[model samples]
Target: MSLPVLLLVILALAAIAYVTGRGRAFRTASGDIRQLHSLPAYYGWNAALSVLLPALVVLLLWISIQPVVINNSVSALISEESVAESSLDLVLSDVRRVADGLDMAVETGALSAADARSLTSTGTDVRALLGSVGVALGSDVSEETLDAAQRYRGMSSYGAILRSVLVLAVGIGGFVIGFRASHKDFRARNTVERVVLGILIAAASIAILTTLGIALSLIFNTVEFFKVYPAADFFFGLTWSPSFGGGSELGIVPLIWATLYISLIALAVAVPVGLFAAIYLSEYAGSAVRAVAKPLLEVLAGIPTIVYGLFALLTVGPLLVDIFGQGGLLGLGWMKGGTAVMTAGLVMGIMLIPFVSSLSDDIINAVPQAMRDGSLGLGATHSETVKQVILPAALPGIVGAILLAASRAIGETMIVVLGAGAAARLSLNPFEAMTTVTAKIVSQLTGDADFASPEALVAFALGMTLFIITLGLNVFALYIVRKYREQYD
Candidate 1:
């Protein structure tokens, strides 16, 4: 059956169920709902769901399997001799293209009368052959053949009308059924609650499924990549280069070192500033001060990373060049490149300050007031109390926040792309040029290199490595935070 017909059937059943349920719930001797087992609405909902859910499931399954089945049948009918010369996969692809072309022609009203007749005759012959084969095999003809046979069984104006009517009937039935069940006796509250819970659970499951899908895709592609490029070269080779041509080497050491160097510089800039900001806000700031400072701090987080990248490129880079470049003050001409690890790190650190401070501030505020009072009561100064009692109590949480920030810095792309040099260098100088893994991945993947090539496949390997590193950091941070939370509790 056509998609419309299937949908119509489902909707009609649901509507019928709903109307029936509501009628059962609401039909009263005195037209009053005070004596019902549940509300009239609940019965209607239950009945509608009963009718709709099963039919919808069946329809979904049918739709999901139909294309594959039909494609296979079409492939079989095209003759094994035609495909034997080429690969089966290539033949299947050609069959699909032919099917798609016919569909497009029909949709656009572009098929000649002669062509349409020929196609119809071919379709009929194929369907009959498939049915005979299925029967001879003593099994149900393949679902594909069966579907195709049914589809080509007729071509009349009423076929479209029938499909439409089926869909309309299903929808109307479901609505009527639901309405009928919406009676005083129906348990509407319970029914609605169940539905809400199901929706929430489905949404949660989707998030988890999406994460798993991404991880699996990365793993699959990386495995394929490793088949072409040795794991040792990818992981530990000192030189970093990925050529798109047949001869390519995909070493990751320089990229890894660059990533580490950038992250370290970012942390070095962020930790001290963010820590100080958190201390001041949590310990010293009054309500009014906090109200102003907190939003301003959050505003920093709200700024787009791209904006930070531009700032790094246009503003910070030139400033650095003037101060430390070939003709700058103190005459340290070694710092020539305006865009370097230091520039990217510094901008990235500024971008991450809010994340670190916001988290640390919350943890600091959660520290027991009693601890501070006790330290002060023991003759410690206010600063001493905070230093000795509060900071220690909040240390784990602060560490967790910092680790999260480190992950952010590592994964950051725009800032490094804009400010960090593209050269994959192993220099120790912060002022020298460098490139990071993310930059290389973006550069390599955006071009027209074949996906099956080792050069292109290397991007997947890099992505997998990035995923593992970030995943580990987040998990460790969570573990430490949980441990610290338990301690405080």
Candidate 2:
């Protein structure tokens, strides 16, 4: 009996239990007791959960602890001479690798005749010795020693059977218990509600844990980076020309400038267009127009950022160069570069239009209709009503949305990678080629060198900065939404 077979058997038993429980619950609820405490479906769900939870918990604990327990036993069996000669970590790595190799060879039918003979002889000796050791240790000697000894034989037939039996027994037990508990008197609804709440809490816990893990990893690495490169050079220095060459320098000011410039340009393009579109849609556009246009605009958002990157590279960059080329647009030859801050920014703005408009429209529509009616009743024009009442009411939300969009623009990688030039420079002209922190991080991390290099460490520092900025923006957005909700509700 393999693990997969055991799992399939368990699943089949659980499914059967669920069906039986549902039927029993339904019959009991329909009896002449006036009414059931909860719905028949809820009772069924409660029974199914009871069947599953304990078995799953056992399985999880078994899987997590089994390796450590096995490894510790194997370590104790190794010769003291061998243990004294090598580091614990190295020996453990080797032992694990050997165990893994044996397992793979057995699974693939690749064990040689010599190896098979050696394994058989060693397994017998190990089993005989391990039993005495286990007895001395005051545990179940025969069973545990036999299972461990089987590892050296390149055979796990008995152990596999036992594992399968245990798993199946647990699953079957859970199913039977859950099925028996499903009755008219059971508080099935409350049980189901508790399960749902538990699931939500688990999901939230995982999210927080993941965030903390990332923050810790970044902080540790950034501390190491600052130790190697002084804080002053990293923070205040203007030059950023780090490379594999001997005289490499690394500074963040130029990258920061490029990021700010590109984001500013993106806001310049997205804000006015998105705001006007939201205003028109909410205050003036007919339902028919809204129905056709809303989803179509959202379709733009659905387009992948990589696709936008290609669009920026092939379509937008060339168009910008052509329009502001040397022979055109007041003979501004200096603005002829195909990849520039403006090109990336413009493309990013296009990408964010849906983000801005959709958020703005929802906030605008959330304003009380009575406010609009009152403004109209006072003989205010539609434009005036929107300008004075709706827009003002939704201002905080709109500002929050814009800040979020700014963060997004700052974090954007694809458009900048394709459209913004790779040269890190601090120039006022948006037409000139420039690079951003994200672009530099990508460049540094992708280089063919040791991962322990100072250049590589810089990426973690940059990532930390980016993470903090985005996290701040999100926190601010949540605050705005909460405040607005309180005001209206």
Candidate 3:
């Protein structure tokens, strides 16, 4: 069976187990639920967990292991002479794609089962056949690749059948065991609670493990990057140029400068506007106005960042060019084109306003109402109270919110890629086009650059640096939040 069908069967088994366990519990208690150790729902949950969890675990392991086993088996069949010109991994990928295409063709009745089994590259035009069935190959399939794909498909089909059987058996066995264990005296509630606790712990551990995995991956590749490029050149040098050819400069200073400069401009634009909007909505606005205006303001957040990038590219960039471009209204001749640091920064700042407003509004509302009441009781005006008592009380959270926005601005890629032209210069003029580290990272790894070259590997180092900067910002935000948060009696 397919994975989705197998999953549906497992869920059906769990549902059946739930009902059976509940009925068995009722019978054990002589139809008096009061006589049971736990509630009927708890008993049902216990059986459901028993039936579904183990089967799902087995299914996961099977899915994980099947690919490795099948790949290794099929790869062994690929002769060394066949892959002497091309990489083995790329060849294996093509084999898998062709195999999947053949399976799809068989399923759709475009090719008979017999034809799929006895197909040959020379006798049948494999590429043209696959393309006819809506599977396009980059190149014609060789005889060795065709044979490997056929073996792979056969082994995969067998594995799927075996996997379905084993998973169903495990589910059935768990149901039987759980149903038998459901008695009037059994601690069904405690067992279910323990399972829930284990699940929560697993979720937390998975999050930590995922972060660790990302960090380790970046660290390993960054170390490899440093092995090829000098650390001082990457960190302290002033220029930013990367070429696949030897003797290219790989300085990161210009990229870092552009990142901070753009982010600074973004914060300057976002902080005042977003914070003021939050203050108006949370404190001063009538309920009706808040209801209408708040959602409309936050509509900006729901718009995708790529949309903002396009706005920067089309609308904002041209408007700014009209104002600041050479021989324009300002007549300064400073701005040359539509793509510049100012264009990206302004658009990015617009994108971040909703984030700051939404978060800061919540943080401001979280300040105790008693603080505002006391200020008012002391004859302070509403504006005065907000400026003095409420603002200080919520300052820590507001700082954290701003820092979060700053992190977002720093990490923005789409807007930078579209609005800020990809010229890595350290010029102070915001009108001039310059790129950030993120834009450079995308550009560096985009083309046919070899991973072994510093041009490609530097992407990892840039990623690591960006990761560190964001991490440091988060840490500092936490420290400020803890240190300055006012406690109430």
The local distance difference test score of model 2 is 0.77
Q: Clashes in model 3: which pairs?
A: none
Candidate 3 structure quality by residue, lDDT tens digits, 369-485: 888898999999999998998888888888988898888888989999999999999898999999999998899889977888999999999999999999889888877666655
lDDT of candidate 3 at residue 99, scale 0 to 100: 98
The TM-score that candidate 3 achieves is 0.97
Ranking by TM-score: 3, 2, 1
TM-score, every prediction: 0.73, 0.78, 0.97
The local distance difference test score of each candidate is 0.75, 0.77, 0.91
Tens digits of per-residue lDDT, candidate 2, 63-168, equal 6766666667655655665556655555555444444444555455665435533564334453333333332222222322333444533333444555666676
The reply for model 1, stretches above 4 Å from the true place, is: 1-169, 183-186
What tens digits encode model 1's per-residue C-alpha lDDT throughout 1-489? 566666666666666666676675656524567777666666766776755654565456545655565556455654566456555565555444333444445456665434543554334443343333332222223334333333332222234455445545555555655665566645666876697689799989998999899999999999999998899988988887677667676789889999999999999988999999999999999999999999998898999889999999999888888888888885778678789988999999999999899999999999988888888889999999888889999999999999999999999999999998898878899898799989988987887787799888888899999999998999889988888888868
- Model 3 off-target regions past 4 Å? 482-486
Deviation of model 2 at 478, angstroms:
2.8
Q: What is the lDDT of residue 326 in candidate 2?
A: 88
For model 2, the stretches where C-alpha displacement exceeds 4 angstroms are 1-11, 25-36, 58-166, 244-247, 328-330
Q: Per-candidate RMSD vs. true structure?
A: 9.0, 8.7, 1.4
Q: After superposition, how far is residue 387 of candidate 1 from its true place, in Å?
A: 0.7
- Residue 361 accuracy (lDDT) in model 3: 92
